[model samples]
Every structure is written in C-alpha cells, then in structure tokens.
Target: MQQLLLQMLDGTVTSLKVFVLTLIFSLPLGFIVAKGRMSRNFLLRGIVNLYIQIMRGTPLILQLIFVYFAPYYVIGFSYDRFTAVIVAFVLNYSAYFAEIYRSGLQSIEKGQYEACKVLGFSKTHTFFFIILPQVVKRILPSLGNEVVTLVKDTALAQTIGVSELFRVAQNAASRMFSTMPIFVAGVFYFIMNYIVSKMFDFFEKKLSYYR
Candidate 1:
C-alpha cells in the first residue's frame, strides 16, 4: 500500500513535469507560428500553415511514439522518454495554439493597426502595445481549453514508458488485480483540470474590462 502511494506520487510528478514543459515551449512557439501564418511572405505563411495542419491532423500518441522511438530506429539516436514526451507534446499543442492565436489576431479590427501606424508606432511596438492584449484576451478561453486537454493528454506519455499517472495506475491495478488506482488517477486528472479552469476563469474575469 505504501509502495502504491509512492508510485502514485512519482507519477503525479512526472505528469506535472510534462505539463509544465509543454506549456513553456508551446506558448512561445505557438506565437512564432501564428506570426508566420500571418506573414505577408507567401512562402513563410504556407510553410507555417502546412506544419500546423500536419500536427493537428495526427494523433498525439503516434507523435509521441515517433518522437520517442522512431529516432532510434531511423537514425540510431535515442531520447529519454520524458524528453520525447515533452517535445511531442509541445509540437502538437503549439499547432493548436497557433490556430487559436491566429483566430484571436484576426478578430481584431484592421482600423486598430492603421491607427497604430498613424501614431508612428513601429510594427513591434504596435504589436506589443496595441494588439497583444486584445489577442491574449480573445484567446484566453481557447488557451484554457487547451490546458485542460493537456491534463488528459499527459497520459499518452505513458505509452513511451514515461510512467506518468495512467501508467502508474495501470501498474497498481495489475498488482492489486483491481481498478481502484485507475479511479484515483482519474481523480487526479479531474482535480488538475478543475484547478486550471478556475484559474482561467479568474483571468477571464479580470480581463473583462477589455470586452
């Protein structure tokens, strides 16, 4: 029983690691991709859109397998399971976030940009000062959804031997020949997602003045 508790704790830590790593990497990459998709350069925009489509179209489990194992099979290099999980997750979620950012940016009125230009603001200044807040406000709900999904998606990391929550639960269930640990894992996920939803709700309300 004590061993089960320890394993569960370890699994929870791993899940948290994956979640944090994915968010850290994906958020900035998503912004870059969103900008690329919005670029006036035809080639850049096409390339960004193509990348987003491929990531979004595929299953994350497949992507995790490819990231974690295919490298060794193809090129004789192996990555740690945690690293592979983080990379796959960041890439997959970044694509979705890129679309969210694109939608938010597009929702802004063109007149705002023109006004910024007329005020003699540089592109960078205009984007940072004038456009970013509105884009962030618009995308907060979508971002919250992605965060909630990420809580569940972390379970996919177990397929690559990362020993996250679901994997730990599976081991526990097999040992006990019961499903209690599985239910416990579900509770962990539910609580994590609930906390994320509340945090986002608070932020959304704080940003309501922008509405």
Candidate 2:
C-alpha cells in the first residue's frame, strides 16, 4: 500500500505539472485567440474561427495522438511525449477559453465604451482598467468550470504515453491484477477537483463585490 501511495504521488506530480503548464500557456494564448476571433480583418478572423472550430470539434485524445506523432510522420522529427501532451492540451483548451473570453468581452454594454470615451481613456487603459475587471467577474464561473474539466483532461496525456496519474494507475493495476490502484487514483482526482471547486468558490465570494 505504501509503495502504491508513493508511486501515485509521483504520478500525481506529473499530472499537476501538466495541468499547471497548460493553464499557464493556454490562458494567455486564449486571450490572443479571442482577439483574433474578434479582429476587424476578415481573413484573420476566418483563420482563427477555423482553428477554434477544428479544436473544439475534435476529440482531445485524437489531438494528443496527432501532436505526438505528427512531427515524426510529417517531418521525420520526434517530440518528447510531455512536450506533445502540453502542446495538445494547450491548443485544445485555448479554443474553449477563447470563446468564454469573447462572450465576456461582448457582454459589456456600449454605454461602458462610451463612458470610457467620455473620460478620454486610452484604449489600453479602458481595456485593462475599466473593461477587464468586469469581464473577469462575468467569466469567472465559466472559467472555473473549464479549469475543473482540465483537471480530469490531464489524464488524456496517457493516450500519448506521458505517464500521468491515470497512466501510472493503469500500469499498477495491470501489475497487481487488481482495481485497487485505479480506485486510489480516483481518490486523488476527487481530492484535486474538490480543492479546485473550493478555490473557485472563494474567488466568487471575494468578487461578489462586483455585483
């Protein structure tokens, strides 16, 4: 049991690494994608929209497999498994997050923009100081849901052989020929998601002042 716990702990670390790195890259990339989706340039908007559609329409496991193998198949170069997993996860999730951000950005009334104009605020100032705060408040719930889903989705790294938590559990279960290791991994997942939920709840309460 102790050995199983230790192995799980190591695997959990890998899972957490994937989760954190995905968020770190995806959040900012999502914003960029959102901007492109909303661009005045028709060609840019079309390209971004197409990218988002492809990402959101496809299965993440398929994306992971493609990311892991495409380099070797197309160009005769190989990617490290973890690198491939992170790239796949980031690109996939950024599309969802981009839509979330786009919705929040569009939700702000024209009056707010007019007010910023009346105040002689620069575009940068209006966005960063006046608009973004409200958008963040509005999008927090949706963002939280995505974040929670990301916790579970990290397991998909196993499809590319990244040895994340679920992969580790599968190996252990196969070795022992029992389901106990899988159940233990479930506990780990539940605990992680519980913490994420509580953290989001706390943020929601703190931001209730926006209401």
Candidate 3:
C-alpha cells in the first residue's frame, strides 16, 4: 500500500500539471476566441466559429490522439506526450470557455456600454474595468462546471500515455490484482472536484455584489 501510494502521488503531479496548464492557457485563449466570435469581421468570426464547432463537436480523446500523432505524420516528428496532452486539453477546453464567455458578455445590458460611452471611457478601459468584472461574476458557475470537468478529463491524457492519475491507478490495480488503487484515484478526483467547487463558491460570494 505504501508503494502504491507513492506511485499514485507521482501520478497526481502529472494530473495536477495538466489541470493547471490547461486552465492557464485555455482561459486566455477562450477570451480571445470569444472576442473573435463576436467580432464584426466576418472572416474572423467565421474562423473562430468553425474552431469552436470542431472542438465542441468531437471527442476529446480523438483530439488527444490527433495532437500526439499529427506532428509525426505531418512533420515526421512528434513532440512529447505531455505536450500533446496539454495542447489537446487546452484547445478542447478553450472552445467551451469561449462560449461561456460569449454568453456572459451578451447577458450584460447594452445600457452599461452606453453609460460607459457617456462617461467618455475609452473602449478598452470600459471593457477591462467596467464590463469584465461583471462578466466574470456571471460566468463563474459555468466556469466552475468546466473546471471540475477538467479534473476528470485529465484522465483522458492517459490515452496518449501521459500516465496521469487514472492510468496510474489502472497500472497499480493490474499489478496488485485489486481495485483499491482505482478507488483511491476516484477519491483523489472527488477531492479535487470538491476543492474546485469550494473555490468557485467562494469567488461567487465575493463577487455577489455584481448582482
């Protein structure tokens, strides 16, 4: 059991890495994609829409496979498996986050924008200062859902041989001929999700003033 716990700990590191890196990259990319989706530029809007559709339409496991293998097929060399996991997860989650952002942005009343204009605020200043905070508050629940989902989705990285928590659990279970390790992995996921939920709940209360 001690040996298994140690192995699981190593797997936890990989899982946490995927979760952190995906959120760090995807959140920003999602915002950018949301802006593009809402842009007046027809071409840009279409391109962003296409990307979102493809990402949301396909299974993430397929995307992981593609990301890991495409480089080898196209350029005759593949990048690291962990890199592929991050790339696939980031791209997949960004599309979902973009839609969440889009809905939150659209939910804000136009009067707020008009009011900002009347205050002679620069467009950038108005958006960053006045609008974005409110958007964040509104989207927190949806974002939290996705974050919890990402916790589970990190297991998908094992498909590409990233050896995340789920994979480690499977290996230990196979070796020990017991399901205990897999159960422990589920406990880890549940704990992660609980923490994520509490964090979002805290943020929601903190920003409740936006309501």
Which regions of candidate 3 are displaced past 4 Å? none
lDDT of 3 by residue, 39-145 (tens): 99999999999999999999999999999999899999968899999999999999999999999999999999999999999999999999999899889999999
Instruction: Name the candidate, 1 or 2, with the larger TM-score value.
Output: 2
Model 2 weakest lDDT span, ten residues long: 202-211
Candidates by lDDT, descending order: 2, 3, 1
Compare candidates 1 and 3 on TM-score and give the better one.
3
Question: TM-score for every candidate vs. truth?
Answer: 0.95, 0.98, 0.98
Residue lDDT tens for model 1, 1-211: 7888788989999999999999999999998999899999999999988988889898999999988888899999986778888999999999999999999999999999999989999999999889999998999999999999998999999888889989999999998999999998888889889999999999999999846
What Cα-based lDDT does every candidate model obtain? 0.91, 0.95, 0.94
- Model 3 clashing residue pairs (backbone): none
Q: Which ten-residue region of model 3 has the weakest summed lDDT?
A: 202-211
- Residue 1 of model 3, lDDT score: 83
CA-only RMSD, every prediction: 1.2, 0.7, 0.9
Question: Comparing 1 and 2 by lDDT, which wins?
Answer: 2
Ordered by TM-score, highest first, the candidates read: 2, 3, 1
